[model samples]
Structure formats: C-alpha cells, structure tokens
Target: MKWLVPSAFMAVLGVTIAHSLVWGALICPFFIFAWVRYRPSMKIIAICVGVCAIFMALTSVALSGHESHLTGEEQRLPLRLAQPFKIKGQTATTTATTVKGESILVKVYLQDEHIPQLIASNSPAWCYWKGELERPSTARNPHSFNYRTYLWNQNTHWIFTLSNADDFTQCQPIQLTIREKLDQIRQQGMNHLKVVFPEKLQPIAKSLLFGDRSDIEGELLESYQQLGVIHLLAISGMHVGLMVGLLWWCLLRIGLTKEKVRIVILVLMPLYAIMTGASPPVVRAVSVVMAVIACTMIVKRITLIQALCLSIIVQLMINPVLLLHVGFQLSYAISLSLVLSAARILSAKSWLESVFIVTVVAQLGALPILLWHFHEVSFMAFVTNLLYIPIFTLFLLPSLFLLYLFSFFLPNVTFLLAGMLEKSVLLLDTFSMFLSTFPFATVVFGKPSHVLSFFYIIALFYMFSRWESRAPFKAIIFLLIVLCFDWFSSRFNPFGSVLFIDVGQGDSILIDLPWGNGTYLIDTGGAVQFGPQENQFSVGKDIVWPVLKARGITAVDAVILTHGDWDHIGGTLDLIDYIEIGEVWISPSSYEKETMEELVMKLQNKFIPVQEKLAPFSWAAGNAYFELLYPHDRDYEGNDDSLVIWAKFGGLTWLFTGDVEEKGEQELLSRYSLKSDVLKVGHHGSHTSTSQEFLTKVSPTYAIISAGVNNRYNHPHPEVTQRITEQGAVMLGTYSHGAIEYRFRGDKGTFQWMIP
Candidate 1:
C-alpha cells in the first residue's frame, strides 16, 4: 500500500496535537482513512506512528521558539517592514518584524497622506520604525472568531500602532534580493492596474494577477463568499493552472522546446508565487505543479495524489503551522477529494457532467471547514459555482490578465475594455447577489462539537471508501443522518438564555427562548464614529450578528431600540440586511426629525413595524413577558426618556433600563414600586443614572453593567457600584466579564461569562 497518505495525516496529527487538543481531535479521520483505505502492514503503521511522534516533538520545540520575542512593555522598537504598507484614506496596516525577527501587525493613523507613497518608494525592508507593542485580544464571545489565535498561528503575537505617521523613519537604501525585486514588480503592476482600470475592474485585476484582494468591495466579496466562489477573487489552484497553461503555450509559440519550456516555467513558478504574496492557495498550487514538473522532467513517474501529498508533507516540514490556515486546509481537501474521485470524474459522459462532479466533490471537501469557521453553509454553492466558475475561468480572469498587460504597453486602450469587462462582471455579481437574497440560500448550523465532527469524518470516510470500492452506496445514509443531526440540534435544545453581550461601550442583550420558541434582541450595539461611514466599526455585522448566528438563532422576533443614542440603536439598521426582523420597538416619539422619519420609513418599507411603546405597553414572546414601565405619556426627549423594560422570563423578574438617567428613574419610582431579580444598570452605570434610591427600590439580586473596557467614560462608576453592592446585589459588568449570560430552565438558572 502507498505510504504518502498516512504520512500526510500523521504529520498533521502531530502538529495539531502540539498546537491544540480540540484541533487534534482530527485523529478520527486519519485513523479511519489509514485503516479503510490501505489496511497497511503492522510495520508500516509503526513507521507512520514514529513519524507522528517525531513531528510532535519537533512541533513542541517549535512552539516554544514561536513565542513572542518582545515582552510587550516596550514603548519603542526599531522594526523591519515584512510587507508593503496597505493604506486607504487615513489608516494603514502592514506586517513588520522586530529586531528578533518576530512578526507583529503594525497599524498606523496616516496623518501624513504621503507616508505610504514615501514608504513604498523606498526599500521598505530597511525602514526604521518605533511603536508601542501590545498583546492581541482574544474573542470575547463564544463561537466568535478568535483573532488572537489567528495571529499566533501566523507567528504574530503582538500589535504595534504608530501614533503619528509624520514621525515615520526615513527608509534607507539596500540591495534588493530576488524576492524583493519580484515584490516591487508586483506592487508596480498593482499600482498600474489601479490607475488604468475603473474601481470595479481594479479589484479583479489586482487580485487575479497578484493575489492582493484588498481592493474587493466588502459587499461584493460577501456575495462571492455566499456563493462559495470567493476563491476566484484570489490566486488559487485554478489560477495557477490557467497561468501555467497560458505560459506553456506562449513559451512554445516563441520557439522553445517542450523540455526547455518546462524548465523555464519551473524557474518562473517560485518567482510568481512570491510576487503574488505566497498565500497558502498559491503556495500549495505552485508546489504541486513544481513537484509534478520535476517528477516528469526527471523521468520519475508519479501519480497526481503522490505529487499532492508530497507538496503537503514538504510544506508541513517547513512550517507545521501551515495546516492551521483555512486556505491550506481547503486547498488540500479539495485537491485530495478530486484526486481520490478521479475515476468518477473521468467516467462522466460530458464536460458539463464532469464539471458538476468536480464541483460536488470540492464542495463536499469544503463543507465542514466552512461550517466550522463561519457557522453557516451556502446551500447555493453548488449552483453558484456551477453557473459562475466558467464565466470567471473563461472570460473574467483572462480579460483581467490581458488588461493588466495592455495597461503597461497600450495604456490608453485599457479603460474602454476594462469598463466593458466590469459591466459584465457587475451583471453576474448582481445575479449571484439576487440569488443570495432567497431565505434558504444559506443555512446556519453553528460549529459542530468534537464528537459530531468525529462522527462526520467517520461517515464521510466510510462513504468515500464505499465509492472507491464500487460497493452499494448505503454509507451515504449515515453521512446524511449525521449532517441533519448536527444541523438541527439547536432547535431541539431545551434551555433558554438571557445574555448581555460585550459590545464595547454599548448595550446589546439577547433573550432566546427554549426549544426555538423565540429570539429577541434588546439593543444592537453601535460605536461612535468620527470618520467616514465606510470605515466605521460595525458592532452589528462584526459582533452582535456573529453571536446570534453562532447560537443558530436565524430570525429575531423583535428588535427593541431603547432610545436614539448611537450606542443604543446605531447597529439596528446594519442588522436588518443580515437577519430577519419581525418588528422594531422604540421609545415614544413623533418620528418627526429627519433621521427618525427616514429610519421609520425604511423599516416600514421592509414591512417591519416601528412601534413606540409607552407605559403599560406589554407583550408576550414565547413564554417571556415584557412590560414598558417608564415614559407613560410624555414625548420622547433624549437619553432621559429612554425605554424602561420590565421583563419576566425563566421564572425571574428583570429590569432593562436603557440609558435612563436620574430624572427618569425618579419618575419610575414615583409611578411604580419595583423589585427585580436582575437589573440591567442604566446608562452603563454612569454617575447620572442607577441612583442609590433607584437601586434600593429595585432591590435586584443581580446588577449588570455593559460598558467598554477602560472606556473614556470609566463606566460602572465607583459610587454607583458601591450603591449596588450596598443594596446586596451581585455586580457584573461586561467591561470586566466580557459577555454575561444567565442560562435557565423554567425558573432555575446558572450564570456564565465568556471571560470567566
């Protein structure tokens, strides 16, 4: 039996064992794959195990060496630029290395617009830089993306933010190495594309030729991602194949012998890889092709699977952490699936059938990875990829390549052609986006548990083994059962949760009912932005929505915007497009102001009710009861008139006072006597709210505050916290605890926090 497959899995299992136990749970498939596919001899199995043990030792040692070199207390450190600065408007980001060669992400406020141009024009690697080093932040919510882990996997542990761009150190001259020269050429090519093509076309050209996807518009990128064709926006296996074929034809046309052409292409491949940013997909494709070529040129016959496995082993040998990369995992997974199923693809009756077979196989390989990371799978991937991959492969990509070349020589003729190409792509993009709007285009399953993933792998392996052995396809039934079980598990869950999200300086709470009865969002948090709207941080899109989707909560029964404060209602509009909302509840108001009028009208257009709740306004959602307890008959003013909600759920009484200040609290006191099991501290525990009298009146068992960490406001003020403490209430602040949750069944509940 062949040894490459076992070797590949063993190497991965080794590194993963060292890096993360949860990730190391992947041992299930590797074991099953070896047992089912090969059933190798005991001696061969022993050899593979030895390889695994050796890699485990090596990975542990490497991990020790991978720790951040800097202590993160340094105020200034001279650094080398590892990549060109990427600047847009007033902010720029790049990767830089410390004197100790530890990479850190560098972000700077480009106060001087010329800074990027200045840095790019010089030997960037020789530039001097001084900045404060800070540790990266981990995810504050469960199932949210962990950026800290991402950086660590890339060997980046810290961040350096330049206070002022005007103080940038002048770059010195240096001899450019081959990689440096190639990068310079790449930068020049991208700059040329940026200048020649219209904005719509520039992203396609820059990404296709150079693997720089920084220019793709976020919405369009999301559309592509929803269609599972986002890989087209970067250099991938297809691009590599296209490039090699195009180069081979050109070299032969120019009178080069076939062997000479192979050698020429071999030499250019590495250069092309470096020039295109050496992303995992590019690196994997280039490595595989180079291995195949070298094998053929040396008259050493090798199967495509062997070449692919050889590339994986070599890449893992160089950097074991490469397996952590989503792109690398995806590349190998899809490639392996195609290779293992080559017979089926070859037996297809027509080209269309072949393409469909390939697409289905690739999607099957990519399914778990996508769901694990994103908590959702595009049901439309098969159709979207089937329809659009050809357009991209045949026309858009080639057109971009030709346009890029033409821009350097016949610069004037590029725009009209680029515009025409842009129009065509835009039309296709619009079509895909329209398809994405269907309610069932994508389905959220959240991330699978270790046990579920294990079974999933086993079932998938069993199914594949049956296909390979040309047996009855009954194994697919087990695969489908596992998938359906994982997908619909959340709906069968019986517990409920009232969670106070960590939305940094804002208030956003999720109240989810047991057994998928209902889901409600109290507030969608927002950040105060002083710059361009496009550049603003999206609390809804980035934070709140992730939390919602990760829990398999697809549609919100109601979105209650307590008041008009940016921190209270700002993210509501952003959430509208991403999640289905039944209605919106705002504080009592005339909706006369231009902003209010526009917002109400927009909600009306979507058929989502925009209602103003007054005192005595009560509603039932699932088994939860909510009653408005403040602003009985007054017109909505400012934060003082914010909605005060009294809710009873999971057999507990709770008060949600949204930014209501001392004045509003007094009115609430005069109008109603309140005692609650939980109190959401008003105005993020500002001094002007949550007064001692109010705390005494409410007499909550627990008081929770939502505020940013080390915020300018310094919320949960000492006096107010002292008051809550004096009232005998357990104090919890999002600032200190990240996200706080009171998970319950009937009346009994347990409190949990993401941080703790």
Candidate 2:
C-alpha cells in the first residue's frame, strides 16, 4: 500500500510495457486501472502514466524518422555511425584515448574538412568516408566520387584520417598516445611487485587497481572462478561495501559521533565510487545504501522493502535503459534477495547452516534470472562460494587495504603485505584449479526459449515461496517435472546439431547432442598478444562465458587444443579452471616445451588426463561418433602438427583441420583419403591449406571459414575461395555470416547454413 513499493512495482511494470510495445500494441487500460487502484487521491500517478504514453509516442516518432530517411529498396540503412575519418593534405596530430579490445578512440587533426562546418551540418554524423574524394565539384553529386555508406547508429565521434587523398582512401592511421608517466609508474609497480610477490600475484594486483588484466593470464583467472573468489578481482558492491564499512568503523573508533560519522561516510562513499568510475552496479548499490540510511534518519518507520523499491525507482528515473542491462538487474536482484532472506538466515546457529542458508537463498533468487539470461547453471557454485567467501572477506580484502595503506608511507610494508596476499591468492587459485578439474563439476544447459525460462522461474518461485501449502513436496514435484520435460524435450532440441562458433579468425566449435550428454568444445578462440593494448583475455571471460552459460553447458567433455598457436589455445587456459574439462588433447609437436611443460604441470595438479598424438581415438555419445585423424607421431612443426578430427552422425561427416598449412595438407593427402559432408576450412582459408587436391579429395558439400572482418592478412584468399567454389562447395564465412550450423537428417543429408 506504500507509495515507494507501488512506485517500484510501476517502474518494473514500465520495463515490461516497453518490451511488450516492441512486439505488440501497448495496453493502456492496465496502467489506468493501476493508477486508480493504487493511488486514489494522487493526480500525479495519472500524469506519470500520461508521460509514459508520451515517451512511447516519441519512440514511435523516432522509428518513423529513421524509416523516412531510408532509401527505397533498402533492406537496412547504410549509415556509417562511428568511423575513422581523415582529410587529405594535412599533417594530423593524433592521440588515442580509451583502448577497448581491438578498438581505440583516436583524435586527429586534418585539413580541407572543416571541422566546425561538419559538426554544424551534421554531415559526418551518419556518413563515413575516407578523405580521399576531391571536394565534390557540384552539390548534386554528393556521392559521385564519394562512397556514401550507411551504419547502424550515429553515437560516436568521427575519427579523422590524415593522408593524401589517394592514399587516405585506402588506408587510415589510428595514432596511439604515449602515456610515458603512467607507463613508467606501472612498470615500476610491476617490477617491485614481481620481486616481492609470487609470479601469479602480480597480475591480480594489476587487474585490481588499473583494470589491466593482460598479465592475469587465463589459467589464473579460471582458478579464481573455480575457487569462487573471482569477485575479489573486480571492484564490485562487496568491495565498495567493505570500503564503506571500514571507513565507518575507523571513524567510530576515532570517537566521531554517529551523526557526524554518517555524514562523513555519505561524502566519502561517492568519492570512492567516482574514483572507481562508478559503474552501474556500484552506483546502484551506493544509491540504495544512501536511500536506506536517509530513510532511517528522516522517515523513521520505512521498511527495507520500501527502501529497496525506492532505490530501484530512483535508479530507473536516472537511467531508464538500466532495465535492459544484465549487471544492473543482477545487482539489484541479488541485493534485494539478501535483504529479504537475511532474517531467516540469521535464525540459524551453525556456521554451515548460515552458509548454506545464504547460498541457497541467493542462488534461488538469482537462479531464474541467471537461467533466463544465461542458459547454464553452476551446480558447484554453492560449494565454491562456501569455501572462498570467507577467504575473500578475511584475506583478500584486508591484504588489499594493508597494501594500499602502506604503499605511500611505508613502501617496504606494502611489499610485505603484497607478499602475504600473493601467497593466499596462489593457494586459493590452486584449490579452485584442482576443484574445477573434477569430472562433472559443472553442468551446461543450452539456452532455452523465453517462454520455457519464464515457466522455469515461475515453478521455482511457487516452490520457494510456498504459494502452495505443501511447499517442500510441491517444489520437489515441480523440479522433477521440469527435469522430466527437459529430458524428453532435449531429444528434439534443434541446437543438438554441431555449431561452428564464429570466434573471429579463431577455431571454436561446439557439438551438442540430443541426449544432453556429448562432447561440447573443440578449440577456444584466442588472439595474439602483440602488446598490453591488444589483449582479448577479458573478452574471453566476459563474452565467451556468458554465451556458454546461456546455452546451459557448464562442462566440456574434452577441450581439443589442436595446436599451440595463440588463436587456437588462447582461451583454453581460462576454460580449464572455470568449466569442468574432462581431458585436453593436443599435438605434442605444436607447442614450445616450456609452455607445454607449464600446461602439463597445471593439468597434472588438477588430475586432468592429457592425451597427445594417440592416433585413431574414437568417442561416441548418443547418435554421434568422433575420431581423431591426424598427428600420427607428433614429429612435425607449425601447421603440420595441426590436429585433424573427423565426426560423423546419421550418415553425415564433418572434418576439423587445425591451421594445417600446405605441408600438412600434402602429408594428409599422402596418408589419408579425405571426405566429409562439411569441412571447417583450415587456417581460415589461407592458400597454404585447403589445397586444390585436398578439396578435390574431401569433396565437401559445405565449407566454413572462420575469419575476422577486414583482417590485415586478407584471409580466405580469393584463390582459395575460387578453389572451393570450383569443387562445388558452398563456403560460409564467420566474418560474413555470424555462426554456421550443420544439422544431419538421416535420409535428407546435411542441412548447413549461417544462423542469423
């Protein structure tokens, strides 16, 4: 009945309305009814509902504006939103600002292209053209010599390209800023930390402070996740909460009055938040905490639920788009669950009881949301959190504080603290690494439909909330029914077919079976480590994990390394500790001894079996059959050591060649007869592999090339493509098409094509 609770409920309802509007007509009657029922005396509720209607109208106007701007016969508007632009005949001084993945924002100065005029005219807003075209002789020919390309959105600054008109047309240079001072300081810090800390600890410190994760490495990151201590690395609500609590405790210790202490805490929290860039989740937490404190002091009788609702409403008011953000949703949901479930948990006496209660409640509240957003659930997550939560609270947090506190005044003390923290992190990392290696430690469920996910959540809620009288029994029955449905339905799930994931110039294929038990992964996509600026380690953590989790696959039967090329094996180290990996197969001759030795040690510690070059190995699950084809003796170099695999199901055959070049191709030709229904083109369709003879022999109906867009190497070379075409092969490329899928129908043969 309270205003705040209704307001929060309305805000949530608003998001549902927005989503519904995208698919069907908005229902105005519900809003009017809610307004009349919830706030009989308030006119503002009607006004708010009116404003929402106005916003919806504006959204439609925006969509119409976009449609009106489009040319006839155009399926999609060709607008270049955020492209690097340069003017001809100018010595442009450029500087790079923020570097994210492979993209960096480079500010440039150029001649002939009037910057103020371009901004005023908004000519550069949706058009991306290199400074090569001579200024149009007449206004009528706006695109005569110019290439007027359209882009998806116009939200970023236009980067200027500087060169002669001719040269600039073909190539644009993105300048990198030299952060000499910061680099020197970071280098000094790294050197100092390396001397005092263990090899693994330095990366953690770098990641914790500067968001620089290049040194963290995949293996260590996975270990932290397996140990359930990954949250310790990122500056999250837990970290901010500890900071706030610590500051409050310190102020109280200094004999500050409660009122004064609260004021100081209020002022300091925002400052800390700002320093950390105040990401959405962090800001949400800060706002919620502040709202709770303010209500306690001023309102005197506000319930926690009311305060939480107010927090959500205020946040939504600030950024309505937050409703669509996954992090924002998870943060609020987790916090609300903690607040709602804490009283019940507090009644428990045993430490284990408290841990289990908290874990179960949190997971239960988060399960539906997690499963809704991500298809997979971590079965071992509860156990992992139970073990690592204490370590994170006691060891990691304290050590970080001590390290920072002593860093300036007592440098030696900081080093000592770092050393101690490093040892603890290593121990935790090692433990997680070992646990993750356990067979079936995690379970994967491929993504489910939104409707199914909704039902699953509803079922879980009914069971947990005791809306039904026999709560426990009903909950068990519901779970059993869901499991039974899943088991029965999985037999016909279309995603059971093999998927060649579009990982951008890298090999990563997922093989799903109808029985819910089969091999899941082939290779993990990875990029080369050229420098600190060009690392994709975090991409693997953020993007890859979410995709895998969405599909409900937590463990891969085997992670095929293929070879030691950075692209093939880069994400392997990360996967080993986060997902349950049964075994790792690689070519003995592909990797350097030192790298191989390190991997072997980690694998041995985790008790994961390692198989190298043991030829003609076969694995069968459900209706699918897998066989290892190449690396006879593992006495080869580079592409020759590539692991070639053959898979068959219901008269369909697929082959995966791991970056094998001409030498490997000739070797394969000499040794074996190649034939497949579908072929994963080797080395991204490099001319060196996929030789004419090989193509002729394989006679594949479909060929998939995993390549990046506009890569420097110009992969899937014209000549190689011509060869595949001549062989009557339908070549599907990841860069052009997103992900390629192949499904085998017993009598009809293989159905292969790109999925959206």
Task: Name the top TM-score candidate.
Answer: 1
lDDT of 1 by residue, 1-756 (tens): 157777877887888888787767667456765577767788988888898888888788877777876777887777776467776656777887777777889888756658777656545655566667777888887777788988988889998987655445465555666776787788877777778998877777788888887776677788788777787788988999999999999999999999999999899999889988899889989988998899899998778888888888888888887877888888888888888874843367887877777787788777778777787887687777777789889988888888878877877788888888889877887887787777777888877877777776677667777766766268778878887888777655679999999999999999888877778899899855644555556888889988988777778888988887778776777788888898898887836545556778888988898988788888886778888887786576778878888989898999999999999899999888888999999999999998888888899999999999999988979999889888899999999899999999988889999887
Question: Candidate 2: how large is its RMSD?
Answer: 10.8
Q: Alpha carbon lDDT of residue 636, candidate 2?
A: 53
TM-score per candidate, in order? 0.93, 0.64
| Residues 1-756, model 2: lDDT tens digits | 276765565666565465455322233444555567656665766646555554445444433433222123322211322332322223322222222221112323444566524422232122223332111111111011111111111112233342233232332333223333334354455556556555657777656543345466666665555443455566666776777788889989999998888788777666555545455667776776676677666757777677678777766665555665666777777767777653644357888778766776666666655655544456687787777777766677667656765676777776766777777777766777788776655444555555565556566655555622434677768866874565345444544667666666677877767656575677787844332332333424543555566555566778887887767766766666456788887787654655665776787788888777656677887777788878778575866788888888756788899898887778778877788988899999887888888898899998889887677789989999999988998888877775666654442445454433
Provide the lDDT at 361 for model 1. 78
Q: Which window of 10 residues has the lowest lDDT sum in candidate 1?
A: 164-173
Candidate 1, residue 229: how far the Cα is off, in Å:
1.7
Each candidate: what lDDT?
0.81, 0.61
Q: In model 2, which runs have C-alpha deviations exceeding 4 angstroms?
A: 16-218, 232-262, 296-300, 342-346, 350-352, 372-441, 467-471, 480-495, 503-513, 516-529, 532-703, 706-714, 723-729, 744-756
lDDT of 1: 0.81
Each prediction's RMSD to truth: 2.6, 10.8
